[model samples]
Target: MKGPHRIIIVGGGFGGLRAALELVKRRARLKSFEVTLVDRETRHIYSPLLYEVCTGGLDADMGRASVQELKSGVAVPFSDFERRVKKSRLHFVRGELTGLDEEAKEIALKDGRTLPYDDLILACGGAPNTFGIPGVEEHAFFLKWLPDALRIRARIAAFLEARRKGKERRVCVLIAGGGPTGTESAAELANFFQRMTDAGVLDREAWHVRLVEAGPTVLPNHPEPVRQAARKRLEALGVDVMTGTKLNKIEPGRACLTIADDGEECIREADVVVWAGGIKPPAAWKSLKLPVDAKGWLMAEPSLQLKGKDHVWGLGDAVSFMHPKTGVRVPALAQVATREAAIVAENVTRLLERRPAITWNPPEYWMTVTPLGGHHAIADLGRFVLTGFPGYVARKVADLMYFCSILPWRQALRLWAKGTMVYMRND
Candidate 1:
C-alpha cells in the first residue's frame, strides 16, 4: 500500500560510506527501504595519503593533471561503487546540505532541492579550525581536500625551481601544530628536500623545516614512549621542533609567535606556512537545531542516535560521544568512526524490524600506525609498539584491510596496488 521507506545519509566520509556499504550488504533482508547517500564531493578522497600528494610523491607539476584526471590514484568516485550496488536500493546524490526540518522530515540543499526521508543518518564531518587567526585563511595552506594538497605541491615545486635558478637562498617551511598530520607532513617534506639536495637539483645554502606546537610536546595525545620515538625520528631528519610555542599571527612568508617559558615575542620567516592546526564541526550542523554539546558537536545517546531524536543518528567527527568508562570524549579517528559505523548500521536494521537497538561499546584499544618519513613509522598496538620498516609494513597492511572492507576484492586490490606503487617509490 505504501512505497518503500526512505533512508537518507548525509556525508560520504569514512563513517557514512561504511554505513551505506553495510546496508547494501543486507539488501536482501532489508528490502522494505531504499538508501540514498548525499555528499558535496563526487569522489571519496583517501585523506590519510594527502601528505604524500603534497610532498611531490604523486607529481612534480600538479597543474598538468587535473583533479579529475588524478582521481584514480588517490580517490574513488562514487560511481565506481555501482558495480557492487547494481540492482540494490542504494543511490548517491551530489548536494551540499543547507538546512533541515525535523518536523517535516525534509533536508534542504544549497541548490534549492529538498529530500524527504523516513530515517536520517548525519555523518557530516569537520572543517579546518583556524582559531580566528588573522591572515591564516589567505596565506597558510591546508591539506584537508584534494585541491589543498595540490596547491601545497605547486608551492613546493615553485620554491624548488626558484632555488635551482638562483632566485631563492633557502627552503624555509613552517608547519603549525604538532599532531599526526603536522608531524607526518614535516617528515615527508624533509625527505623530499633531502633527495633534491642530494641530487644537486637545487642550489641552497641550507634548508629548514620547522614544526611548531602550542602544546608541551608533539603528538600530545600519544603515549610517552611514542612521543619520545617520534621526537627521535624528527631530530634525525633535522626538523626544528619547537614546542610550548604559540602562533599569534601569520603573514605572507612570516609568522609571529611567543615562547612559553620566557613570554617573549618571536618572529620566524617562512617560504610557506602549512596549517595543520585542527578542525571543528561544520557550521551547517548548528543550523539544523539538533541537540549539540557545548563545543557545538552533535550529542548522541549510547546507541549512537541523536539525543531527543529517535529517528536520527550521528557518527564520526560530527558527533560528541563520551566513553562510558573513562567519561572522556572519543578522539576523532578514522578507525573509531569506521567501528561506530557498524554499530549504527546494526541499530538501524534493528529499528526497521521493531527490535530494541543495542548500546554502543567500543574496544578499549585500537591500533594506530603513523608513518614518519621514508620507510619508517610508529605503530602503537596497545601494550606493544613497533617502529622503523616493520611499522611501515603494518601501516600498509592496515590500509589494505580498510580498502578491502569498502570495495570489491578486485577493485580494492587494484586501488591498493596503485597507491603502493606511487607511494613506495619515495622510500
Candidate 2:
C-alpha cells in the first residue's frame, strides 16, 4: 500500500533491536523500504543481567548510592541507537504503541498518533505478568527495566538502613517465580547482604533471601540435573529454596503463600518482595484481537511470520515460537530472540523482493548460567555442568557476546568491562 515500502517494528528490546540493526544493513539493497523502530522508552535495557545492576551498582560518589548508577550501568540510551540507526535508513521513534489496524496497515500511539506501514513487526517484548494475584500489582518489586531495578535496589538499601537503625535482626527478601530471574535475584541479594555485613556497613545478622516457585522445582525448563545443581548451590548460599510454593497474595511488606510440601498457607513478613515470576505480551498486542496461544502469546508460523498473515510478524517473548525441531516449545531467552531477529530480517528482505521466507531453524544448543553472587556460578550446557569460577567466567563471556552482537566492538568491550568494574577492584 505505498510509495516507499515501510516496515514499522514495535519495541526496542533484543528482538526489535536485532531486527532493526540487520534491517538497516539489508535495506541498502531494498532501496524502497523505509524502517522505523519504536519503543515507549528512550533507552534499551540489558534485561537478562538486570540482577547485576541491583547488586553490583554501588556508588560511593553519591549519597545513599545513586539510583542513576543503575541507569548508567544497564541502559543503552537512544543516543547509542541513533549513531547506528540514523547512519542507515532505519528510524527510531520514542512512543508507546497504543493500537494496530491490520486491515489498513496502520498503528496508533498513546498520543493519538497513527502510523501506516506496508509491513509490521510486533517485537514489543513482554511485561511482568502478575497472574492476577491479589495485591501483587500494588506491593511487588519487578526487575523488568533499569528503573524497576533501581527502585528495587533503592528499596533494598533503604530497608537495610532502616533495619540497621532499628536494630532488626533479619531482613526477609522474597522473590516470587523461581525461574532464572528469581533465582539470580535471590543469589545476588543474598551475596550483597552478606558482603555489606562483612564490610561493617551494617550490623546485619542475615537477609533471609527466599526463592518461591509455583512449580515443583526452580528452572523447570532446564534439564533436571541443572535444576538440581542450581538448587543445591542456592541452598548452600543460604537461600531458602521454596519450591512448589505459590504466592497467593502480597500484602504491604508481607506475602502469603501456599506451601505444597505441607499443603498449608503461611504468611512471610519481608522487608522487600520482588516479583520475578514471568512475562506477558503488552496490552497493545492483546488489543489487536489476534489469535494467540493458550497462554495468550501470539502464535507464529515456522518461518517466524504471524499465522495467516504475510506482512505482520510476531517475535521474542511476545509470541510462542514452535521450533520445527524441538516440538512445540521455545524459550524467550535473548539468544533465541536475537536469532529470530536475523531470520525475520532476512525473510522481511526476501518477502519485499518477492522471495519465499525461509523456515525458522530452531537453535541447536541450549546454555545458561546462574551466578550465586560475586564470581561464583553454576552453568548448564545440555548434559554438561560446571560449578564455580569456570561457570562464572562462562557467564561473563556470554554476557560479553551479547553486547558484542548488538554494539560495535570497542563499545562492547567498554560496556562489558565497565559493568563489572566495581567488583574487580572491590570498590
Candidate 3:
C-alpha cells in the first residue's frame, strides 16, 4: 500500500486556478495524485472588471464565477482521484489561513485545524496596502476584492441620491494613488457621473472627482508620451489631477495633504474616498518564515521553485523571481502571473516524472488595456501606444479575447455581442 499523494493549492486566483486546471487536464497518468484547492471565497472574481463594477458600467454579478462551476469541469480522472480520497482527506475547509510551518509541512487555519501536504503551491495574491495612515482604515475604501467594489459603488450611488434629494450636494470623490488602477478608476467614475447626469440620475454640478498622485506625474512607469496623453484626456474630462501631493491623513470626510512644491498643507473634503495604493503579499506568505523579500513576496529561483524547498513552488503576485537578463525582479502583473503559471505547471509535471524542469523566461513585450469610460481607452502595447477610437476597439477586442480564453468560442461570441449591446444601451 502506498501513502496518499496529496497536492494542496492555496488561493483561487489566476495562477492557482490555472495550475489546478492544468493538473486536471493531465490527470490520466497521475491518477494517484489528489489535489485540493482552498480559498476563503466561494467565487473567483475577474479583478480587471472591478473598476467597471464600481462605476456602474457593469453589474457586480458579471464579475464572478462560482468555484463549484470550476470544480465541475475537472476531468474524469481528477474527479475519480478526488472521490477516492476520504472526507477528511478531501478537505475544502472554508476559513482564513493563519500560518504555515515549513519544517512541519502543516498549514494552520483560523478554525484551529492543521492540514499536511505532500506538495504545496502558494498563489495567495496581494492585499491593498494602507501604509498605516491615520483614519485611512476607518474611512477610505479599497477596490481590491469584489465586495469592496460593490461597497464603493453603493456609497457613490447613495451620495448621488442624497444630492438629488436637495442635500448639501458637496459630493467630491478623492482617489489616492494614481497608478493604472487609480487612473482607470477615476476615469470610470467620471464617465459614470457624466452618464448619470445625462440620464437625469445626477447633477453635474453636484459631483466632482479628484485624482491625487505622490509621483511627479500620473502613470510614471508608463511611456512618457502615453502618460502625457492620459493626463490630457483626464484633464479634459474635468478630473482634478494633483501631482506631487503627499497624503498626510484621511479624516471622516476630509483628506489632509502636503503639497510637495509649496510645502503647504491642505485639506480636501469628500463624500467618499477611494484608496488604490499599491499591494503587498498576504499574511500567510509572511508567516511561512521563508526567504521573502522586504515586501513579503516569496523568493523563488529561475525554475519558479521556492528557495531552500523542493517539491514546492510559488507564482503570481506572491512570488518574486529575478530576470536573467536584467537581474531585476519582474512586476506582479496579470500577464507575468499567467505566464509563470504555465511554466510552473509544466515544471511540476516534469518533477513528478523525475525529469528536469525548464528555466523561465520573461516576455519581450507586455501590453495593457485601460478603459476610460464610454468606449474610450488607452492601449500600451510596449513599443506603441494607441488612444481614442482605436484604443477603445482594442480594449473591447481584448475583453472578448479574455472571455474566449475561459469560455467556448460560440458562447464567448454570444456573450460578447450581448454584453456590448447592453453596455451601449446603459450608456
Candidate 4:
C-alpha cells in the first residue's frame, strides 16, 4: 500500500499477456504501478494455429520451411510488447515459478530468486492431461508447446521420408481424444497427407490417420450441428473416426484401445501418436495451497479474484469459474481467457482506486471456430453456426482481430498476412 504498487503476472499465456497489456493501456488513469509479466518462455505462442504448424500447413512455399521459420509465424517475443508500449512500467521476466509465499506476498522461482508483489495474478496455463494412462507420459507426443509441435512435424516427416525410400511400407498416425485440438489435428493432418500424395511425394494408400475419442462423439461438448459438421469433414478427409473408443494404453509404435459397446480390446500399429486428450492445471499450484476445484484448478470468483484472496487473481486454464447464469464452468478457450483478462484488469484498477470491483459476465457473441482442413471450418456463434469456406474465413478474420487487440495494426497485419499465406498452402 506504500510507494508504487507492484503488480506481477505469473504467466505469458492468453490471460497474462492480455492483462499486462490492458494494465499498461490504463497507465494514464492508474498513474503509479509497475506491471511485471513473468513466464518460463520468452515468447507467447499463438496456440490455435499449432496444429497447422505441425502438419506443415504453415511451412514456407514449396513446403521447405525450417522449424525456426514455422516458429516465426506463431511465437511472439515478450520483448516485442516492451517496444510497443514505450515508457510504460511493463517488465518481462523469464523464470519458472517453483513456490509462493502468500503471507509475504512474494513468488519464488527455480533460479533462487523471489519477486515481491502487492498484487499477483496467476495465469499459468494447464498441461495436457494424460488421465493416468499407462505409457502415455513416456511414449505419447503432446501438442501443447511449439517444441512439441515441431517434434511431431519432424517425426511425421521422417516417417514419410522413410516411405519414399522404401524403408517403410506404411505410416500411421493415431490421435487421442476428440476435443477441438484432436479433431483439428486429425483433419489437418489428413489433408497434409493428401497434398503430398497428390504431388507424388507419397502414396495415397501408404499412410493412415485415425482419431480415437473416449466420449460418445467427437466435439462432444459442442452443439449437435458443430459435431456433425466436424465429423463429416473428418470422414471426408479419410480420417478414421472411432467414437466411443477409449485408449487403454500406449507403447512405442502401437496403441491399445477398447470399443465401448463390445469391450473388444484391440491393438493398432501407429508410427506416430499425438495426444490432444485434455488439460489440467499445472501441479505447481498445489504447493501454493490456494483454493481449488475438485479437478485441482484454482477457483476464482465472479470478480476474477482467487477465492478469499482479493489481492490475488487467477485466469486462463489454470482457474475454474462457473457461469453465473448457465451454471456450467466456462470452457478454457482463448476468447474466454482474454475476456476474463479484460475484466481482471478492470477489477485490479478498481481495487487500486478503492472502488468496488465489477463481475465478469460472459458475452453473447462468444464464438468457437475449429479448422477442418484445407480452407474448411466450423464456427459456432451461439444461436447460429457457419460451416465450410465461410467458417474458415471467419476463423482467419478472428485470428487477425486477436492480433490487432495485442499489437500495432501494421505488425498485426504483417503477422496475419504471413499466417494466411502459409496456412492456405494446404488448401
lDDT of 4 by residue, 159-187 (tens): 76677588988888999999999999999
Q: How accurate is candidate 4 locally (lDDT)?
A: 0.88
Q: Model 3: clashing residue pairs? A: none
Tens-place lDDT per residue, model 1, 325-369, is 888888889988888888888888888888998988876566788
Q: Which residue segments of model 4 deviate by more than 4 Å?
A: 57-65
List residue ranges in candidate 2 displaced over 4 A: 1-3, 58-66, 85-88, 163-169, 203-206, 423-427
Better of 1 and 3 by TM-score: 1
Per-residue lDDT of 330 in model 3: 79
Q: What is the C-alpha lDDT profile of model 2 across 36-132, one tens digit per residue?
A: 8899888888887788767554524324444555455567886676677653466778888888788888999889989999888888878899989
The residue-by-residue lDDT of candidate 3 on 343-414, one tens digit each, is 887777777788988988996456887777677888998878889878989988886786565555876686
Error (Å) of candidate 2 at residue 302 is 1.4
Better of 2 and 4 by TM-score: 4
- What TM-score number comes out for model 1? 0.96
For candidate 4, what is the TM-score? 0.96
* Model 2 lDDT at residue 48: 71
- Provide the clashing-pair count of each candidate structure: 0, 0, 0, 0
Minimal lDDT window, size 10, model 2: 57-66
Candidate 1's C-alpha runs over 4 A off are 58-70, 203-206
